[model samples]
Target: MHSKRIRAILAPVATAALVLASGAAAVTAAAPAQALENGVARTPPMGWNSWNTFGCNISESLIKQMADAIVNSGMRDLGYQYVVVDDCWMNSTRDSAGNLQANSSRFPSGMKALGDYLHGKGLKFGIYQAPLDKTCAQYFNSYPGATGAQGHEVQDARQFAAWGVDYLKYDWCSPSGTIDDQVRTFAKMRDALASSGRQILYSINSNSVHDKTGPRRNWGDIANIWRTTEDITNEWDTGQTNGYPMGIQNIVNVTVPLASYAKPGAFIDPDMMEIGRGGMTDTEMRSHFALWAMMASPLIMGNDVRTMDSATQTILKNANLIAINQDTLGLQATQISNDGTRRVLAKKLSNGDVAVALFNQSGSTTTISTTASAIGKSGSSFTLTDAWTNATTSSTGSISAGVPAHGTVVYRVSGGGTVTPSPTPSSTPSSTLVSAASGRCLDVPNSSTTNGTQPVIWDCNGQANQRWTFSGQSIQALGKCLDAPSGATAGTKVQIWDCNGGTNQQWNLTAEGTIRSVQFSNLCLDVYNNNTANGTTVILWTCGSAANQRWSRV
Candidate 1:
């Protein structure tokens, strides 16, 4: 890990307790500071960074080439703007006046000149810095000297402004301090940028690949964009490379749960993208780009743009996915369900459309599905447009596809009215409930009338225990309704209890064949662990496209 230090600042005890109680890293030590209202990154910033592809090998000429390619390849028209030169662009040491300078050998044209060249081509300029005495490469790559901003936050901010820097990637390379100290240090830079007489988009990496402190929640309040996971490498699934979790799937897992923190101006960055990096399959690359767009993450390309192939260009310039990422609603897609191998995410667009992504993580091709209602949509008719191929389909609600291994199928669904939970249907006749995975009946063991009797998948038997009736959203069998116990959570075993008309007992029989609990719509009646053996238990798990969670009436 790169080493750095933070000047300490005491925080109020009560404020610290409040943040800690909420399960967030305590960052209340400093006086409250708001993210700069620079009117940029209202939607997640779209740009390119040199780190993933070039690392510390950046130079003025290479950045110019990227800028020229972005414009000539029509990427600029599609919103790829900022051309950021990551660490190593700075000299190993400060100048006589204690100001940081561009490495004279690589950036002979100078920082301002490089920025001017990009601006001349209708692009923006971005740069990197650390809060400590050395950047990650300065320590790890043995690049000499103390180039970090540390106590010179104001001076560096002004210098960046003077150099026409439109974005700042403030990294937490090596830091010595409490979480409070880190927050204070980052805030000082934020303040410096705000006072720098320019609107620099503030991006910070408080949790580097080497840091184990996890992401701090208050980052949304301190910077426009904040890194939520370790640096992402060009791989499809989790594997450690240089101590960082390297893969698209690993970063997605780390970022999905942080959706609530993203809004119009604040974005939860999962790190720059690795699309077209050659380490992942084309399918996996599509999945990666779609996932980032769905999550409202910054679309900072880390691939060498100057020589990208047509397929790479196509994926990078996907207009529909780009629009979804730049949606004015600025809401990050929520992981509605994940069954280890299959995951479903949904985000609402400002124009009354909902974007849904069905991702298959397993090695084999699998059928994945979700319903409009499950994704917070309902209507008599809906239009589904495949985000990649532009294939259009109409449906009442069902959305499904045979997604390839490590692939994602994204759909922009429109024409659905906002969902309004309907009252229970009037006296629906009893039917045998069969599990799609087990081909067995949902049976109450021994025909037990005892309350709290858990349901299980058993051999299809023509008995009262296997007969279930739907009434006003309740699934009744043997004089009881299927219920999720109070305070029930994912993995909670579902049981038969007296139907008191509670939300937990109400279920939405979706068109895609899922029986979703109304109380927790994101969960479904899952055959435990996808085990098809007779007498397997039934529990509520996240609503995924997995067959174990699917059910049918007979």
Candidate 2:
């Protein structure tokens, strides 16, 4: 996980309006302009990282044991091949000649020997470093050292290649300067690694604090796998740890909008997996895994493989889910619909198959439904194979399931003759309502599922609270209609209420990018006082050409 101290150096949080505006631009130009051709990570890399479970207390013996367990537990044959050692492996000081060295006490036989051992077991080796003055552990745990690769990118790259390093996690610790400077700094290491004559999978953490950079579309040209959000803790929803959003859902929200950036050899990294970590329930873990795989993210497990229970093992070793993740098409899943508690995501596969996920983010069993045509499939008949249970069923087009709360049902849809994928629609029914003036999202306070919660303009996190669906003339979220509240007028704050077909609950999305109240067509949804800060109240005001009243569905 990211250290609290390092996170403090992040630039002031951008308003949701700015985030949504940039995200819109990114999605428009998401086609890979120039991607790294390192010839690695053709599919999302699957492996284990020593961070979520062990943190900085990692050792050579522990890594070796995990490697042994990976093979003995059948994870190796399941495509979990990389064994990564995160921060704190380096000594407090560099050796004579200013060369980085491993802490002798932890790895007495040295990194080269450990790498050789892993290679002998048919696994790859990965290590971590920072481009700044120190690693995260050095700052958070007060580890003695300034062992960074700031001015020694070439030297360190050669050193790691000599040690048989197959992967390098280049982290951004206390990054300064403009985004261009950051890009150049990272690309310098990329070049150095290329010259090292070893194919090292470079994974970078550039937006660790959700800064103003937004989703960097140019990252594909610099690194093989790039971290798209802050570190992930072993929690289900948007839980906070040390004042930072670190839950699975929190990270998922940030990642969902970046689906267009992933391609073969350049995958998105949502940090590492916390599957077997004891912080979440089994249902949540399964959902977490399903979301990651659906997003085409690197599946770097962060749990103790040697001690994983049967349930944990089963979730991690699901062959069907893994197949979707490693699909040769290298396409990430797109959100077909999201009605707060329930969401549907679908990805296109290489063999004329489509992977669909019905996710229930609620607290009770809910019947989520979607159609093959909605997911970009055209078939006379389709075979739906349950990814988890291996149960098969036939369907003409409709796909529905009673998904448990915090659980997901994934299916591989085959027999869809030649797969006629629909053209990307101009507007999705479900979308993040972005304000043109502020660039933030229209959001419900605290992701409340109850009725009568007023909405606001906040930084876009892609959470359920920020997702709204346009059905008929009404805009809805959490299965409730956006209402004008009783005694409605031009200045009334907009709140969500049970859909009653009320005039105040109906809306009309104008071609000019304004959401006008159907009952009061002269009035428009507005950000109170044109404030661009998070938590700004959203109210009804006279329809005008003001930018604050202009909204876009993303």
Candidate 3:
């Protein structure tokens, strides 16, 4: 999957992001201004796509069924607003003069008629296209020929918008080169869409927005949502390929880089979630959904909603997870830690509670005792509310998190405001946390200090660059990591690192009580054989039920 220049969507670490893979290039129009201001992109994008239910067999009449089902199911009111059609709607044949023609047999009524039906139902309609000349299906598309110039690309986008399309799912199936050019091509359509004034929701296929390439591909407020993965399939029967959908690992990997990019106009889409798709255990789907919601990633479903079982519906409609996404503050979640099957992600919800997740990505049952402090809160003992379960939970000095493998433990954490999060950043952030005076140092060695040399743990003494917030158990001093001990290099020694708050330095607290360093990841603290000593030599080890590894900030 090659990425276009414009597509800086998240890509697999090795390949980076393949911008605008496919199902992009359709910009209906700028959506009404009010819709976006209300955090439309913040919540998981609840809706349907043709690929899941209909695949390449899409037709005008079939889309009508999807729209009807969405309206009849009352899911639209629940936030399933956009009814999108994936690939294979294009026809290779042109009329006598060279105009694109609707495949008469498959779509007898034409696209306008279908748009009328969906718009009539009070739901928006989405169409798909690609930056390349042909879609992945080998069907017709727009791309540069051997000459490397988009033959009829710009015109096609205009036509789609003219038909009253609302959402555009652009893809970058077979582009010529570089994500920058791909973005410019999409920009052409984005500019064309401006002529229509539709404010269409632009959703590029996964991989157009690789996080490594830099700040969201100079899109300049063009596209709305960029995919961060390769194509996701709806069936587990498929091989472990791009189509497998987003697992917890994908969310954990992609969300950190993309979180800062989320704003009023655009979002980082981790492709469509495969929660209802088979292959994943129920617990796994819960974990997947929980993480996606916490990260505030786009929530397009790759499952057949028309046949969604109650079990699936229950998971999809969890008011707690949905509320976390709908939270007005609109901050996205970041990974805290993972204990084998157990993984955790945390975000500050607008309603004043921190949304915390204890997930079982392994899909097997497991016990993980997580601490509250790791999830960006203060206090030793406190009461908790299970917003997902719709009931209050027991509050002790700490929380006992037992999650089924593939399941999740989501909480709406609330307590007295013991402290504020890390201080807000100044205009241009710096690597050093320059305190007004002296302050305690974290992630530093027990005692070490030499300018440009690694710093160490010591009580605050009005140090100029020590005061910092351990937000989400992550050091926010200059937005970098105070890495775990012995993790200095790939294997040198772990030490607190510098920052601009990149993924290399984020850590999350697992629901099962354990501390995780975001930068020095997966490895947990192990007390010397579970010894409970002030300086028990916290060797880096996988998370377990050892009491020594667990610590709480009062």
Candidate 4:
């Protein structure tokens, strides 16, 4: 299924490349000559797009109503400034002189008048276009033979700027061209917007299919926010579609690896959101919002602002979460741990705090946790505040919570930035791993001298494996490192291995009496399934405060 999708997208691109190469001069001639240093979009853009909710149904009246609702609903005050018209706004064809025209039937007052109205409401106006000869929604566009901005880049940009457009969303509907061709076309638009004497936010959508590790252009160099995934749908979980249909989770997976490309002036977009829509619950909305913020993604709301409920309003207006998103540091979060059923993500905030999210991906509710050490903060204590509930707590080491199925618990953890050194680094501390619940020692099966021996809980027999030495971030059992296997996931059996400096072998004994692994960033040494019986097996899982995950070294 995935291969066919890739092939379908690539074929057009390859054909377009040959055509573009043949007419290179004509394409270059269309590029704008003048340039302006438009350094807008220092922070991630927050606005409302007309595509996800309205699609091809956008009109001048709907836009005006949305603008009014944005102000009255306090969205404008919350820093959502742009009112963007996505696609299908253009007329059937350009004028005799070749200028794009608004659909007379839908936008009789024209785009300029609409931009003026939005500006009067203190909102910026955004316009959308396709770089190709036609957009994906070409059938609904202005005219039968309507051309995109491909051969009229400068002219279209000037028209948009003359219409008082403050933002430009350039889509890659017909993505056929070489890497240089794509870059030149995008740079042409960027140069055009710059020369238009309008400091418009240049947003490019190269389409997510081009995002894989390949000879693709660096969109971050020119775009304020570039779509990194498929278009989002109004679903909480995975959505089914004929083409690429993305839900919140699917988008996050696509966004996980593109963190380094994002910064103050640019962000990796996961496409427009479906917040406040009927397909998802409030809990799912909260999760979606938190993840987007943590990723430093553009918050382009895609719901009918005039009709959403109060819960949706509150989630959208979350000032604290928004602040994290617009932080001057502009660092996107990365997935710290994912063991199939549960996952943990952490982002570093500008104020020396970490925004951590524990997500329950399973169908059933599960206990999840992560320690301060797991997030690069060891020794010091942390104070956590639930971003959604405003609940507060402090932990010297680990934080745990019972997360509902498909729900997320986001916390802002402060302090714990400095790692306190051991009283004596040269001295290795030997201790017995006493389970906080069973009061038994962590024992190597049968006191075996072989490698790959799994660990277990047994009566305090003072065996070599039970009597472990901790030093230099490694816990050694019988001269081998107590370890979780490489690429270990939840329920992967824990065993002993030769003391290699791998992350799976590195351990940190936290102040809260939980063991953390550097390799599994947000995972902890946990007893399998709350089992306290002898030989119950030990493994790495999402951190939790349950007795099974708690241990004391003595």
Candidate 5:
């Protein structure tokens, strides 16, 4: 099994505790992140990261060697670029001039030199950092100590860009108490990057993949990518790792996380890929790439790109899936069924067609049938095009197909069918609920014009802002709510503040659609005055349906 690291930072869970304490959890504002360029990913990103095989053992020599390998191995031709360096490159001390420097022992030639080499080799370079004082490494906090430096922090990003960095993996640590601070920190770098006149891709890193915080407004402006898991470990033997493990579980883990994000330029990242690292079989790897593609995730290959085998190459080069992901229209799939396994994958293709995958994960292969009504709207019909077999099938009510154990069948369905606005949903007698969303989900009102004023939740009156949206899976109130005390904790008492479209502002509604904390689920959707007094200070309470705590949206 590959080594999976679960050390990403998390917001405190106390605020969420109050949510469960109240027994009422309702998400009024929950949606996915918007695409980077309003386009979906055609294929999963095809690139290399240093985490899978190298762990904390990476160095300049190893990086260059892998770059050489990627080229010689023909990975570049298959669209793999970006030679990413994970953690451990930072140093315990910065130079006297107040400049953050790379660890000389590990990178003697310096990151700039390394960046030059990658650029010369026709590849991009990526680095990592956290929003808080330190990374999970817990050594030299990037945020300087009492003997402070210019705390603006944009200078650090400039240094990386000056060294020719094309990607930045910004982790959320050293909680400022709100996703806003987390996202704003990255925004600092974003401005720095844009001004650097460099096209550096920014990535946000957090620990939870299933949290239900609302959207981080303007997230597209801050990052090109964001992590949806705490950390992806190497493969495990008994009782697999969290999120989805490498083999067998990749299909389940990866797909479940996909539905939340998966918008256009801004793809939802399920951490790095652990392909060719030996925990998974060739079929599993294919499944990994396929799932990422269908979900429109960035295809960052976590395996040693330089040493990948021929079969890995074949899997990474699935042009059909890649094309679909890279298509200009970035609309991603909304899971028809969020059962995790026994699942269906889908997306709207560029040619105005919808692609879907039916997967049977039960031990015994089973035939799964989905009527048109089951797959889409009630009045519309669609023609199903199976991308897996290159066949076209049509259905008016639903479509059914037989699949093997741990296997899938993908299709492209198109028609002039009507797209139904999703039905107003009903609450289930939920057996399991993960509360405590990292960024407190601001309950939004239909049309409040005050930007700096605290946000309040009115009934679902259907105004653009009140109709909270999600980037990836994180939910966000209109760009007008506040994350109380700036960065709210799980049980952190919340008050509406002016919204800034920051991480603190965004949230992800879970499969059950319960509004929970983004960093943890120990909290639940809560309402003001248990759905009573209009200004009862709505905070996360344990999920229970008191009218004040109850919320519904289609």
Candidate 6:
């Protein structure tokens, strides 16, 4: 997969690709780069990037507008600082002295002036490049040519420092076929960045092909954040790769398994976020943000900030979730339990509190509960606070709640019984949503991971959309309360509405596993036409002994 990944850079005109690929200036040793002493990126880097929103269509005006928006929109006050230009910022060819040049038309002010503009606004500037003869973008797209730091790593590093660049995302596009070559190539750039006498947070990108190819290189010793997966799209839970883009939930599943490899100075990056892209439901976006926060991931937003709505802005700037992410301990959360339907993940914080995410991996609203000891906490009583809603509650040894399909409930629980006052929380799934028909589960359509994501029935694939729980006497999924439209007749669609403790939102799961609405006991939960395939619509029908009406927890 790394062989197929693409990006762009600049090179000289005289047979540039051939020259950089000749191994003329290749370093032979395999070691971590010498780190600078500026205390840069002591924790995961918080920033914004260009690739997800604009791709190769970046300009000085756009960059300047984004910098202004971050300050004016209060994102800077919320701890988002860096503005990175990823890929395609370089010209087709370098200058006479073999210096990489910013595309003159798009960046008339030059790289130095642009860096100064960002610095003047109290923000940092970051840039991207490939360690190979060409970037993944150029190679995969079959462009005329591309460039790298292969022959002139030191010169490029010096130029970047001179331009006051604070971060660099060094990708391994079209790199050599061996792991040692990749490591040594990155080390060459790392040492070059250090020799320039500037404190740059060096980010090394791993070859996605080599991600599962046996043992991994020591990227943490040299770079701040190493990419763990391919590009992330606005979708969710898709592992299908035809050299195409990925979704937010799919990326979460990819990076969740690599938690042990993350730490304070170095992190496992899933790639830039696609928030405010209008591709996912609000609930899906919240899950994406919270999961990335729990992973201690580099929160580099990849969306158009200048036009984000209030809800999008609020999710990105959630102070409590950000606090859990930026906590000094910098511990990445790990999955602790998976009982075929629900999965629980927990991260021990530096503040003696544990951040827990109860993920419902089923479709129907089921009771998903977990004890404190199950999450590595040794206590009888604990105080819990929801990060998104800012709601506070206490739990004895275990906490149970009804979550909606494909929803999550994230809470910060203090060790033992030390109750701490906190702010409110938001629409987050606290349990898994399961279905009773054909042993299937409720899920977001097409595995959609965004707000206002609708629920549908799908085979139990253990995805995020299939998670739901019954908390507070309401069927909830994707953080929205499951309800039949007000005064709807039988066979009307059951939709995910705002949780309001209304009668339509309440359901009774009888001892026979039949789910009946409290507002209308005569109607029972039923799959449309007894369809057993995925995407089947669920509706209220008269109670019967039919297989479609016989509900049971799997």
Q: How does each model score on TM-score?
A: 0.71, 0.85, 0.64, 0.69, 0.64, 0.68
Which whole-number lDDT from 0 to 100 does residue 100 have in model 4?
96
RMSD of each: 13.9, 4.6, 13.8, 16.3, 12.4, 14.5
lDDT of 4 by residue, 1-554 (tens): 01112312332222112111121111111111121236777778999998877878789999999999999999999999999998888875789999999988889999999999999999999988888777657633323444588789999989988999999988876534545566777889988888888789988776533532111333677777777655677777553323356667656644654555677777777777678887887778888898888888888899999998989998999887898788877777755555445677777777778787898766688998988766656566788888887888989979788998888888888876733222211123345677776766688774453468888887654323465655567776544578878788777888887655678888876666778788887788888887778788888888776777777665
C-alpha lDDT score of every prediction, in listed order: 0.77, 0.79, 0.53, 0.72, 0.54, 0.69
Writing each residue's lDDT as its tens digit, candidate 2 over 1-554 gives 46333443334334444434332221222344346899898999999998888877889999999999999999999999999998889997888898999999899999999999999999999999988778877766546664889898999999999999999998876735346667888899999999999999998877443331134344888999887666677887654423254677766655665666789988878789999888899999999999999999898999899999999999999999999999998888877766556778889899888999999877899999999888878877999999999999999998999999899999998886554444331123347788888778898786554567889998775545676756677787645679987666888899987666778888887777778888877889999999989899999999987788888777
Q: lDDT by residue for model 5 over 1-554, one digit each (tens)? A: 11123332434333233234333434333343554441222334557887667766778999999999888877777677878887778675567865677878789999999999999999888886655555645533322221211263666766776898887776654323345445556666656666665666777664322222212233554566765433554442113323233333433333343354555557666567665777655655666666666767677777776666778777776676667666666655555542323566556666766666676645567786665554444456677766555677667757678776656677766776535324211111111122232223234332232333344443222223334433343333322233434545444554444433455544545444455555444555565444333333456655553444433333
Cα distance off (Å), candidate 6, residue 409: 1.1
For candidate 3, report its TM-score. Answer: 0.64
Candidate No. with top lDDT: 2
Worst 10 residues of 3 by lDDT: 427-436
Lowest lDDT block of 10, candidate 5:
423-432
Q: Per-residue lDDT for 250-296 in model 3, tens only?
A: 33433443454565456666657676677666766776677777767
Q: How does residue 15 of candidate 4 score in lDDT?
A: 15
Clash count, one per candidate: 3, 7, 83, 5, 101, 52
| Local accuracy of candidate 1 as per-residue lDDT tens digits, 369-404 | 988887878776999999999999999899999999
Instruction: Report the error of model 3 at residue 170, Å.
Output: 0.6
Strongest candidate by TM-score:
2
